[model samples]
Target: MGAIGRFTISLRLLLALTQMAAVGLGGAVHAVTQLSRTDTTYTRVLEQEAAGMVLVTRAGLHAHNDSRLLQSLFVERDMPARQRILGERDRAQRRFRDAIARAQDVLPKETAALDDIERHFETMFDSGQRIEAALLAGEDERALRMLQEERLPAFESFRRVAQTEVARLHRRMDEISEEATRKAERAWQVTLLTAVLAVLLALFLAAWLLRRTVIAPLDAVAARMRALEAGDDRAPVPGQERADEIGRMARALESFRLAAIERRRLGHEARTDALTGLLNRRALLETLETLAGGATPLLAIAIDLDHFKQANDTHGHATGDALLRAVAQRIRAALRAGDIAGRLGGDEFVVILAGTDEAAEAVAHRLRDTLNGPVEIEGRLLRLGATLGIAALPRDAGTPAGLLEAADQALIRAKRIGRGGVGRAAARAG
Candidate 1:
């Protein structure tokens, strides 16, 4: 698949798995926490019910004592204390009933311990009512006897039953707590296992993807660089399918290598002049065109070697070619970086000077003076003179064709005036 497609697929899969894991973990944690909180609330209710039963037992004992005190003292003021004790007992019974209702909501269906506790509370209430009625009827001995014998026995048994019920509820609560603990431990184990597996899967996928996309490509480029350094141009490397920046870089490098080879081949052809190695007329025209279009003003100096036909007659065509090559080298050495110096075949050469005046007279004078330097041919130095024709851009003519023609006319003028002299082209009027 394509690089982007592969990345997207991997990313989507990872995201989906991650989301699923998160949801599962969240649900599990919430269930565990809820169960734990419910267990705590149920345990608190059982304790509260157990406390209410203890209060009911104490109030029953106090009622029995108040009945005994009423019989022994027979004071009218003791009636209020008796009433307060009865009221306390009633409140405790009410609290016990409320606690039982709360416990029913929490405990499992029809619990045996809860049933026993309810039965014990009913018996205790009936015994208390009988004792209270006998005392109110002024049957003091009968009421005391009933409380000491029947009611006290029932209350004691009720306390034992309530204690047993509390113990049973506590046992059930402990069981639930243990079960919840086991469930929480299991959840933790599962979560840990899932997290470890996820990490391992992520690492494996990351390594695999890195190898496929990045590492492999980098290795290929490294191998290519090594091969290039070892001069093995034929070495094969994987090319990019995408048009991204890396692909563009590879393409650019390939183009540069090809261009370098082509440049070496062209350099040989460029060195030789078709007509004479004196730089062809095509080369001269190209140089003049480049200078004319420049932002800086330029002077075009056209030089024609003096008495070339007579020298050819005296020596040979081979001697003329040698002289031209020597002159071309000398002129090239004398020029600056931006200057253009080239031959127009036969015995003619051109020099383009940047930043020259409109008159072109200054450039002509410099060239005539510099050309006075000797030319070395086959270890023999020859002193030769040349005539120069100068034309400045925008002053002579605006276009390349006009500039060349004007320079040629100036050269003709120099030859007509005198050999080895400088001439300038007249500036054209707007």
Candidate 2:
């Protein structure tokens, strides 16, 4: 009776929360649907009326250009010049015809404004033919009279009527915007009013559920989960010691946290070097490409262990491997959280500094000093040094491969100055 009594009280709280969420979700969906319908109406205007207007504008411009070209043809005494103008007019006619054909899509019932445009075009075209005939027959006075009386007036009428139609389309689109805006405002108001009332009712019913032990602890748990999701894997899931529902929930959340950590560990292992536990060559290249693409400043350091093969020959492979691991440890200690290091097979390693400032240069210098330090392996003191070649992104080179090549070249240049030295890429290009 006591156990049931303790849990039975939660039913009212659960019901209130569930109902509140349902109402909120429903209202939001409804509002979005209404807004979407309104937006769709506006999109229809763009798809239909605006599209038709573009065709109309283009056809009108070409027709106007054709009229000007015809006048030029009349004035041009050279046969070649007249012929060129005629060719241009022919192209203009083709373009105008194509636009009219395509514009049938937006015209009234699939023939919007096309009939009127074609009528005006035909009238002007007939007048242009008569003018052309008069000009070809060397009747200059007759051609001038035809152009003045027929072609010019027809073109004026065509432009005026087309402008009137465009003005009508503009007015229609304005009406559509006003109508949709009104509908959207009404829908948002209705949905918002309904949602607010339902949420208020839910708050009243849920007032009893907001105790410190239950609500506070649950809120803490939710916050911890959010932190964990945001990459703070160490965020603790508290309240696991409680002998209640909260404890059980805490235990479940702890399991999820553990699973997430394990998954991340596996992901790290996949990208990591098996020997040094740094990033492998493939991961290094991938990281380099990603950083190079971003806005952040970056530097690449190419490190080669000086006399590594000689060490292997003298100390055997086991000693050489141990020495490499030792160098890797020093390299890791010298890097910041944002920096990355990778082993590119035997004796070759790379480090990526996240900054371009002298602080980054300090890290490189520190790494070189540490790597140059001697090591005692199996009671034998052996010396190893690292030669470093460095390059800055978009300064020495722009691409990942180019940066790497420049770094390598710097390494070669540094090695020329003897082991344990640093070589930098060429001076920045202005």
Segments in model 2 whose C-alpha atoms lie over 4 Å from true places: 1-232, 239-245, 293-298, 313-317, 332-340, 353-370, 413-430
lDDT of 1 by residue, 1-430 (tens): 1222233233334434545555344543454345345434543543444343333333333333333333222222235545765676666566666656555554545256556766776776786687678877787778778878886677678668766655664565456545545544554454445455554556666567657765566567567767766766564445545453234334434543443344444444343353334444555566666556668876778888886666555766666667767677767766666677766555777877777564346546666666666766566566667898887777787876677667777888988998888878876877
> Candidate 2, residues 1-430: lDDT per residue as tens digits?
1121123223334334746567546655566566556655555564476667667766776787678677755545656556777898889888888888877756665364677877899899889988887887899899999999999999999998777776776677567656656665676565556566554666655665656556677767778878887878786698789865456556656755765675566557557765688887668878888777677777889999887889888988788778878888989988888888988777888988767657657877888888877888899878778889999887888787778788889999988888788889987567
TM-score of each model, paired residue for residue = 0.40, 0.42
Clash number for candidate 2: 2
Per-model tally of clashing residue pairs:
0, 2
- Give Cα distance to truth, residue 9, candidate 2, Å: 6.5
Best by TM-score: 2
